[model samples]
Target: MELELRHLKTIRTIAEAGSLTKAATALGLAQPALSAQLRRIERALGGALFERGRYGVRATALGELVLERARIVLPAVSELQREAARFARTRRDGLRLRLGGTHGPLLGALVDRLADAVPDTTVTTCTSWSERELAELLAEGRLDFALAGVCGSAAPPDAPQLVWEQIAVDPVFVMLPDGHPLARGREVDLTALADEEWACVPGDGCFGDCFTVACARAGFTPRRMYETDTASCVHLVQVGRAVGLCRATFPPTPGLTTRPLAGTPLVWRHLLGWHPAGQRAETAATVLAQARTAHAGAAARSDSYARWLARRAEPQTAVRRRAGLAS
Candidate 1:
């Protein structure tokens, strides 16, 4: 079919937003014009590209298949445009980049590395952010890199728009009051605590749908009676209002002990999230590179905190002290 970059963008926008009207507002096109644009493309393809329903315009099977390839088209075109400009200003332009992440320790080390390695670059980072808000800001040219947890691998597969480079794997644990019953257990499984009240972030937030998947794999959906996407929920758990699921690497707060679930997969992945390709805010790549390495080294910190977590899933006395926590 005779499709172009704009058509591909229209499809991705509709898919991510789950509605034509919202995509229109984001893309700054009138509703009629957007509708006609999609219709013409589907005509060329000899099939409907989007399914209209109560929720919004969702990609048809064909549209879903097309999106796999189309997702990269726009980004490749944007990068091509920028490469020419970059070639011209190879040695003269300075990089001004902004990076954001919720997994703080790893990224903070990355920024320090970037400062030492790339003196010409200036990067500022933030932890504890909303993915939707961060994605919006990054798309609108406000931010560059995002250090989020891993996203699912359910893409159409042909397009291959994302790359997940794992920096570290940390165990999932239950955050409980200082003296909760399960606090002293070396490890506890979800099935064992099927009846405990749970506290977690909303489904759209970081621990969203994935939490349900993790719990399902553990043999039960959590009895999540509370759903506040903040650290305050940890406080709720502390006061006996709810219990929480947390990765050892992304602790909600102090005095909340974490014990591993005997048979669950580790849900903590430190991921470096970025646009596949786009008109980035100048210094995005340099910052992203630093982040990837920072997570690697932070994971390798041979120190007490690292050993301490290892101790939790085993007898604490088995951990041998490793120095170098300072820096």
Candidate 2:
């Protein structure tokens, strides 16, 4: 029965709209519902907030006093929320960079770059295999940024409150034991390994479904697909129990060789996400640039990926040349 911020907001809306019907319309409430709510608010305050008139409505003396207080309190509370949001973005010691991500080489590289870029700021990271978990954390304000990947052209997490920016896109590759016959190939055909068991890290995205569709298009179903952690997936590949899927930029592992899938049946798009209303929005551009640089560094260090990039660009370059010749 006590006055609440929502009740205050209703009072203000009624005053601005100048009539109950108009206020109900503005607040998207049925007139009866709004009237009932106003009656409750008036009871809580022990007075009427408005006087009906031929023209519209006017505030009574007590209502005027309440209105004046609402005017002061609402704006002050709004400013308080804004200031608290700014303050909550940092830690007690100073500025802190909180990052959450799914297991990937890019997360480590991004951490390295962020540390170097902001030496005085404390950088912390949490890794979850679930992209949805990271998105939820970012929306809840627990993490300042989220680094995730989605299957080609698939939307990022379902969080509409967060803004997601593309950091890089890479063809998804397959990992094989060094002794495997396909290890020496520049690219392996999707159907070439149809009989091989597959292992992949579990994540919340359309990648699993996309993989199934890709395999179907390749004229075979993947055999015995296993969902496990990243390390376990690599171990499965190392022990030759299953082929592992990974980003093209996966660092070279001692017992395994990673190669792009021919025809690029699958692709990954790296994304950086954060709440746009958060203080981090101000520095999102800087963070995105650093993340891109880190991703480039990782891509550069992978010889196979570098060669793949070069080969992938040749078709575009040739098309441009053909167009120029035609002109």
Candidate 3:
């Protein structure tokens, strides 16, 4: 009754469901109990939140105002609960390293190295979030470290609370169904698929923005037909519905294959972020070295990507050779 998250949830639920009976069913409470709870909450707030009518329940002016705030506060509170759970699990592990980030090949190696380096410390990994969120987790000490990608142009500013090291810069690849016309080769030009609909996560974050910039440089804006994560995006592509951008090191998906972009215009910068106060500063260098090795291993495992790297390195190798001859 003092207006906690439960009270906010109850108010929001009732507003969404449009009646106490439905809200009770959704919240697993009897209608009478739910009605009493609502009354108590209204008493605490000094205002009626709902107007009961023969047709259905509707939010009063006060209810609308309260619901607006609940919408913002509930998600944040839920995120806090999740982060706290992670922090608690880490504590129970006794000297643990918690790492969080987007799914990538480098995580396994990072875990292995951290485990070896710490000896007695348990290493835990969490993925499926954007780099910015991972960085925020590192800042909050919910995570000891994070290996995540950031837009090279709009990367976060340097902060006193966290240290970020640039680990890798890699091009994004186009994932297409095996039967798609463009899937016949190992490389696809960005402009060739200008007419095709894209399946992308609808966000202003790294992936979406990078795709937009890459398409702009290629002289066309991609048509988004589906908005979803990589897993669901793969399904859309598999059904020949849409195409998506993926990392070169992404594990092969059945019925689909990935091709490098012609100029590799879509690029992502991978960074290792850690809060200074969370871990021994000395471990940062070890983590960086491990991450570099992991990235290299990932690249090497992809034959087409390995060939591309070799082709890209040829000029640098020639320069080094010429420098040696001159010396």
Which lDDT values do the candidates have, in the order given? 0.64, 0.89, 0.78
lDDT of 2 by residue, 1-327 (tens): 988999999999999999989999999999999999999998988988899998888899989999899999997887567556646664356678788988888989998998888788788999998899999887766788889989999988987568999999999999999999999999999999999999998887999999999999999988898999888999999999999999989998899999999999899999999877775555788889999999999999898899999998999999999999999
Worst 10 residues of 3 by lDDT: 151-160
TM-score of each: 0.55, 0.73, 0.65
Q: Compose the digit string of candidate 3's lDDT tens values, residues 205-227.
A: 66676677778888998876577
The CA lDDT at 121 in model 2 is 74
Task: Please identify model 2 stretches exceeding 4 Å from their true place.
Answer: 1-87, 90-93, 280-282, 317-327
The candidate scoring highest on TM-score is 2
Estimate candidate 3's alpha-carbon lDDT, on a 0 to 1 scale. Answer: 0.78
Cand. 2 TM to true fold: 0.73
Tell me which residue pairs clash in candidate 2: none
